[model samples]
Target: MPHLQTVFAAVLLCGAAHAQNMIRGEYWIDQDLGFGANNSFALAQQPDVASIQLPISLNGFSPGVHTIGIRTIDASGHWSLTNFSTAVVTTEPEPPLLTRVEYFLDQDPGFGEGTEVWSGTGTDAPGIGSLPDVSALAPGSHTLFVRTIDSAGHWSLTVHAPIVITAPDVASDIVRVEVFNLTTANDPGFGSAAALTVTEPQINLVEAALWSDDPLSIAQGNTLAVRSMDSNGKWSLTNFFSADVVHTNVADLFTQTGITTYPNPFSEGITVRSEDGQPLRVVLYDPQGKLVHDKVLNGETYIDLGQHASGTYTAFFWKELERIHRVQLVKH
Candidate 1:
C-alpha cells in the first residue's frame, strides 16, 4: 500500500444551494457526513404553484395588511428562509329608526281651557316635540297634554295642559249659625226663661221661633244650622250661625233699629243691637278681600272675636237691596 493517502477535510457553506440534489420533482440533501466530510447548508426552492392557500374560519377579522411565512424541508433535513405574504379584511356597523307616542287631556271636559291647552304624544308635533295641542282642543274650556317614547328606550318630551278653576260665588249672603243664651236661671236678669225668636225678614225666613227653659251659654263659639226649601220642594240646609235670640224691646218688633253692632274696634265681642222688628244681614271681610264671616241678626247679636287672630276687618250690614253701614274692627 505504497500510495494510500487518507484525505480528511470538511466543507462549510451557507446560502441557497450547497451539497443538495434535485431528484424527480423533489430536492434532497444528505445530512450524514463520513469521517472526514461534514457539511451544513440552507436551500431555497420555489414550487410551480402560484400561491399557498390555507383555509381560515373567523367570525370577525382585522383589516389591512398581513404577512404569512412559508418554509420547506429537504430530504437532507434543512429549512429555507421564511417568506412574507399580505391580505386585507374589512367590517362595517349597522343603521338606526323610530318607536311610540301617546295623547290625553288633564281636565274634565278635555276642551279649550287656555292657550295651547291640549297636550299629547309624538315627536314631530311642535315646540321641540313638547307643545300642547292648541288647535284640536275644545273651543270654550278644557285641558290636555301628550307624551312620547323613542326607539332607544328614551323619552322624547312631555307636554302639559293649561290650568283653569272656577271661583265660588260671593254675592249670596248664605251663612251658618248656632244660638246660645247669655243668661242663667233664677237670676231675674231676663235670662234663659225668656222666650227667644230668630228671623230673616229679607229672605222671608224664620230660623227659630221658640223658647227653651234650659239655660245655655255659648261663651265659646258655636256652629248654627239652617235649612230652606227650594221652589221644587227640596229642603236644603245652606246657612250656619253662632247663636239665635228673640227681640227684647217692644220698639224692636217693627223696626230694625233694635239691631246694632257696637264697639267699633271691639277685641273680644261685638254687640249687634236691632231696635226695628226686622232681620239684618252682616258680612265681615278681612284685609285680603276674603269673607271671614256672615250672618242674619234678629235680636241682640253677640259676636265673639276672641278666636280670631290679631288683624283688622271690615263689617258690612245689609237688608235686601239696602246696605246699612260698613264698620272696621281691630283685633289685638
Candidate 2:
C-alpha cells in the first residue's frame, strides 16, 4: 500500500513571548530529525503568535501509530519546545471485515482457542449465533467472553458479557398436606390450613382425617381444595374434591355429656370446659358451616376467635361419635 499523507496544524506562541515575532518553524514526524536538521519553513510577516500548518508525509512509515511534532524559531533564533500530536494510520480503505466469531464460557481460553460459532463469514457484522450446550455448567453467576477475527487473521479485543446459569428445580418430597373449603369466604388460603402429616408423595384424603381447626369440613358436594408443600417450601396447585356431606341435629344429639361451653358472645377467644374433666372434642364452624376449629381437650381450653370476622359461629361438643351439645357464639 502507498504511504498516506496528512497535514498537522497547531497554533503556537513563539517561545512564550507574544511581542517576539516568529521568523521560522520546523517539524518532524515519527523519528525525531533533531532540531533544525529536519525540513524548515518560513513564517510570513513574522507574526508573534503564528498559526503554523505543518504538512507531514508518511512516505516510508508503516501503518500504525505515529507522532508529529512542531516547534518555532523566534526572531532571536531560539528554538521552542516541540509540541507533539499522535495518529493511527492504516492501509485499508475501511475497517477489516469480521471473518470469525468465537466464545467461551466463564473463563477466557485465549483468542482463536474459544469455541467457534462462525468462520470466514466475510461480513462486517455478524448477528445472533448459536452457542454450545451449557447444561454441564453449575448454577450461579458466570461470564461469557466473545471475540472476532478479521480477514487478515487479526483477532479483535475480547468482549465479555455475563451469563447466569440458574440452578434447575429438583424434585422435592411432599412434607405437608392441607385442605381448604373453596365454597366459603373464610378460606384461610394456602399454607394457613392445619398441616397434615405427609408420609408419602401421594396423599389419599379418604384416609386422612379432616378434624383440624382449618375451615375444611366433612361436607358432601362442597369443593374441598387440597394442596401439598414440599421440603423446598414450594406448594402444589390445589386439587379440588367434592364428597358426601354428613349432618346431625344438635338438639337431637344433646345427651347431657357433661361438656359445657361458656361465653356465647365473646371477643378474641372463647373457653370450652369439660365439666366432668373428661376428654372431649370441640368443633367450631363458621356461618357458612365450614369447620373452623376442632380439637380434643380435657377440662377447660380456650380457642382464639379474635382473628375471625364479626359473625355468628357454632360450636359442637362431641364425646367420640356422640354429639353432646351445640351453642351459637358471636364475635365482636
Scored by lDDT, the top model is 2
Where in model 1 is the C-alpha error above 4 Å? 1-259
Q: Which candidate leads in TM-score?
A: 2
RMSD of each: 23.4, 14.4
Query: What C-alpha lDDT do the candidate models reach, one value each?
Result: 0.42, 0.68
TM-score of each: 0.24, 0.38
Please count the clashing residue pairs in each candidate, in the order shown.
Answer: 44, 3
- For candidate 2, list the clashing residue pairs, or say none: 220-243, 220-244, 220-245
Q: What's the C-alpha lDDT at position 239 in model 1?
A: 36
Q: Write the per-residue lDDT of candidate 2 for residues 1-332, one digit (tens) a residue.
A: 74476756664544754556677777777778787887788876455554566666677678888887778877766788787777667785765788888888987777788888877656655555676668889988888888888888888888888888888789877778887666763558778875766656765542243333333343323456677888889888876655433343333333355555556577788777765786666778877777778776777888887777778887666554322355677776
